[model samples]
Target chain A: MSITVAVDAMGGDVGLDVTIPASIRFLQDHPEHRLILVGDLPAIEARLSALSADARARIELVHATQVVGMDEPPQLALKNKKDSSMRVAINQVKEGRAQACVSAGNTGALMATARFVLKTLPGIDRPAIAKLMPTVKGTSCVLDLGANVDCTPEQLLQFGIMGAELVGSLTRRERPTVGLLNIGSEDIKGNETVKQAGELLRGSALNFYGNIEGDDIYRGTVDVVVCDGFTGNVALKTSEGLAHMVSVFLREEFTRTWWTRLCALAALPVLRHFKARVDTRRYNGASLLGLRGIVVKSHGGTDALGFRFALEQACEEVGSNVIGHIADQVALQLEKIQRPAVEPSTTPETL
Target chain B: MSITVAVDAMGGDVGLDVTIPASIRFLQDHPEHRLILVGDLPAIEARLSALSADARARIELVHATQVVGMDEPPQLALKNKKDSSMRVAINQVKEGRAQACVSAGNTGALMATARFVLKTLPGIDRPAIAKLMPTVKGTSCVLDLGANVDCTPEQLLQFGIMGAELVGSLTRRERPTVGLLNIGSEDIKGNETVKQAGELLRGSALNFYGNIEGDDIYRGTVDVVVCDGFTGNVALKTSEGLAHMVSVFLREEFTRTWWTRLCALAALPVLRHFKARVDTRRYNGASLLGLRGIVVKSHGGTDALGFRFALEQACEEVGSNVIGHIADQVALQLEKIQRPAVEPSTTPETL
Candidate 1:
């Protein structure tokens, strides 16, 4: 089966420098796949002049005159920059020209444009940003990283269902364990929203694993960890800050003296092994789940290798029909509870 | 000037095994300081048999018939266990026999008992848990770590005031910069509560540094980081989990094979330096701020060294008069706002 992905080649910090190379490498590796590179046509052509005919034949260039700034507000980008590469890429997915869309552009603009163009899957009140986190056992999926500041209990249940479907389909797990993120593992803990969400999760048809704390994200205790965006965003950023501090401290210790530097050289191999096992590049892609079509957001400052992993992530989601699985799961859940399925709204909430 | 701290002798997971030795070491180090050990008389006397006469002269033992279980409900412990060691230690502070109280028991019970016995300072709505977090530049103090699940905008402002005063007095900084924890640094970001709190913080007398993200906590962007208990607790626990995972990953890599083991031996000194720089025991104690008396809660599973640090934390708070400073700061802020200071209520909110 051939799968086509629309690439925002003019997005991210490095723009064409990272995305073009990553897209070329992705196409070379997967001959059964194709890409529609959306950006400035002449600039993209300059970068692709060195490619062979066979490789060139598998790529399509879509011209985009405007580019979204890295700090552009979501509303302005959605209203003004209609011809932006980020918007054009999402249009491909909306128009059925591509199976998925991948962008390393401004996250807010990407989310706003994608929601405006592709809309959301039926019964999903809001789209959630789900990311794969590296865990001790393997990996876990955590959602609502920063999409919604405040969430209702019903919205939290939707996030859980979307996350569970994403994980189950991608990892081939029959029923992924879902945990409600809270301050404590006990049922009687946390604020009113989380407690209510726990009760709803327990009563749902999903495999609810009770409440889990912040530490459980990396413990691999559950396959899907669900929480409101405020808590999830804070936890994710805190982890990043700590990780960066530790690395800086390690570098400082390793170069404190000539003897220590020599010792660091001797331990280089073991350090490399440890680094590979927990590389952030391996988990660069974040899925914008609950949308009508698959959309993957890559980190803006990542290199070609990191962006390639994001492309691979998009391919995996496409191959597994994540959107279809999530839609079916939500419909089934709504039916079980006898709740009426709401029609998908055209005007979605802005980031 | 001499400072006296009441110690809960039969508290924590290890109880007397950790607390007794830690108390002895603390008294030995601070020659001018005294301790009131509150617990079972017979067990306390048996542990003090080996102490020197001079050391024993600085210690006073009080008998308490009951011990609060590590997992005891706060309301149950407050209502039923009238003579519990945790309660007795707080009672010493209430009776003016001790300047501060240090415990390694259940946090919820400790907070409830301390608040009930000591009462909150004038104009302070609720007590917050503040802990010193090691940052890139020295250490930063963060507050409301699981003290109140739901906090109002006024309560968040109170937290900021208390945390700033705590950091300022402990570090001897005339004006410690305070940062309100938010999902983003922009003023337009965050939920309604944080946005209103940001406005309140800016309008107050604190050295407000606008809004800060979770990464800023470790970046040393501000001397004091203030947030509600829910977000603060999750961030703190998430940091602990990530730190533990990194150490575990490092160990697994070091002992993977004989060649790696040899490399690890060579890197032992550098590794030791790295470990010592980020030692969790160095920052063990968490202060319950806004209460009338100083109370420090130590980690329940810590060893004697860690518990002694908690003792040292209590001494520092006493020596610097943290509670007086907080009371004065809150009063000054309240007077400036033209708000009437409510009389201290007999029935305070429970955990």
Candidate 2:
């Protein structure tokens, strides 16, 4: 059976220009895959017309009149964006029309729509979004980049389980080590939520690596690092900012000294290869896990090539049977498992 | 008439090897300055003997028998470490015998001791640590980096004022913009702490840059970024890790192909220059602000040279008279300020 990736053709600015072509390119590169484009028939067609004739035949367009605005209120959009390409894309996966859905849209909206349309997987309390980050040694999977800002102890534990399963399937590691992102490596450091999360994670079968410090993220210390979206997002942003800052600084420093410039001349070959590994585009598409169907959220500002790269990643997710793998793990770890009695509250903690 | 920096000579591993030599270099470099090294006389004397004979006459040592262990609790250490190099260092500043104190020791103990000895300025309830992070545009100061984890509305407002003044002192920018790190650029999205702080910051005279997303840190969008210690520590660590990751990855990428290797050689000059700009050693000292005196804390793992850098930084802070400037500003901005009629409770509300 061939893999099918449903493209949300209406969300991002580059959706039409980039997603369609990238989808075509990915399909061409992987002949064992089928493509289903979900969006307005004509716009996608106009964009699709730009593709070479032979490649056009490999594409299939599923018309949907709705489009989820990239900036729509997440909650409100999920309720009303029933016909949106993002929702329709996920619906295709649910209907077995596609293997997974891919979109570069408002993160919250996509997550909300995914939860609403496809529903969370069995034994899953809430869904999480995991983004692949390029680390020093290899790639690190960072979860809850922006799924739920306020998660419970159980939710965090679920994230750890979910993240472990996802990384296990997608990466070379079979049983990836999971880390709880906290202020300190010691047990006494994190807030109450993290402390409780640690105890719960410690009990799970997933390879719990205990507490990991913020500085450990890029050190390639663990395969997976888990945190709520608020902290995770900040961490992600800080990383990006620092990366940019450092490179800029290095450029300035080397150019100032003629001798260092000579050293730079000899080091160029190794440096470019290293730069590619850390480039943000290398790990662009984020997996939307725990939802009923596979949905990938790519950066909204991605270019045509970036969109294509995301499409390639989506294909990898489909080809690897990653979702099925996660579902299996989720079944073993949580599906039939008895849940402890606990209060589920949505009120914010007063601090 | 002379600038004196109290050296916590008993602190860290290198002690005077790093401390004494750096101070000697500074005094040699600046003949206008004076030094009062505070620590055990015997150890300092043993280390001082190694210094050049000419440099010995310019230095002064004050004996203080106690030393604060890195593992000691902040409160207990402050109470018991009367003879600690940290205590004596701050005390020297308190007695107006020294203009600043520099230590590579237990940070919490140093903070507590400094606070205890120096006392908070009249309007300030707590002091903050300001770390100057290298940015695309030279550098930016991030305040409250692990000094205080959780902040109140009034406290955040004070941080903004404090951070603003610190930035002004370094960059001399009038009305330097202060950005409050948050989930989104919009003021509506953050937690209650951020929102309440935003309300307070907006009301204050300091230039409020509104919400700054995490990516803004490297963008050099603001002069000062203010957040509680918990978040600040996360940001700082994340940045450090990312920089390391980037350097490592660039090394890997540049070696993948001969052509890439050639590219690496070509880019070597640029990359080396980048390292110097982002080098943490250039910006390692964390200036203890809002204390009665200038107390700079160096990273505990620092080596002799790093200790020397901290010493140089301390001398600069003293010469700059940053503490006195902040003290004056606190008096001017806060003395006549009207505090809110209602006291905010510290109890966290569970939703």
Which one wins on DockQ? 1
Lowest lDDT sum, 10 consecutive residues, model 2 chain A, at: A335-344
- Scored against the native two-chain complex, candidate 2 gets a DockQ of 0.51
In the range A180-225, model 2's lDDT, one tens digit per residue, is 9987777766778889999888877889899998888888788999
- Write down the TM-score for model 2: 0.89
Chain A TM-score of model 1 comes to 0.96
User: Who wins the TM-score comparison?
Assistant: 1
The number of the candidate with the highest lDDT is: 1
> In model 1, where do residues sit more than 4 Å from their true spots?
A339-351, B339-351
- B220-294, model 1: which lDDT tens digit per residue? 899999999999999998898889889999999999999999999999999999999899889999999999999
Model 1 superposed RMSD (Cα): 5.7
Candidate 1 residue B311 Cα shift, in angstroms, is 0.6
In angstroms, how far off is A333's CA in candidate 2?
4.8
Q: Candidate 2 lDDT, tens digit per residue, B296-330?
A: 89887776566667767777676666667777767
Lowest-sum lDDT 10-residue window in model 2 chain B: B335-344
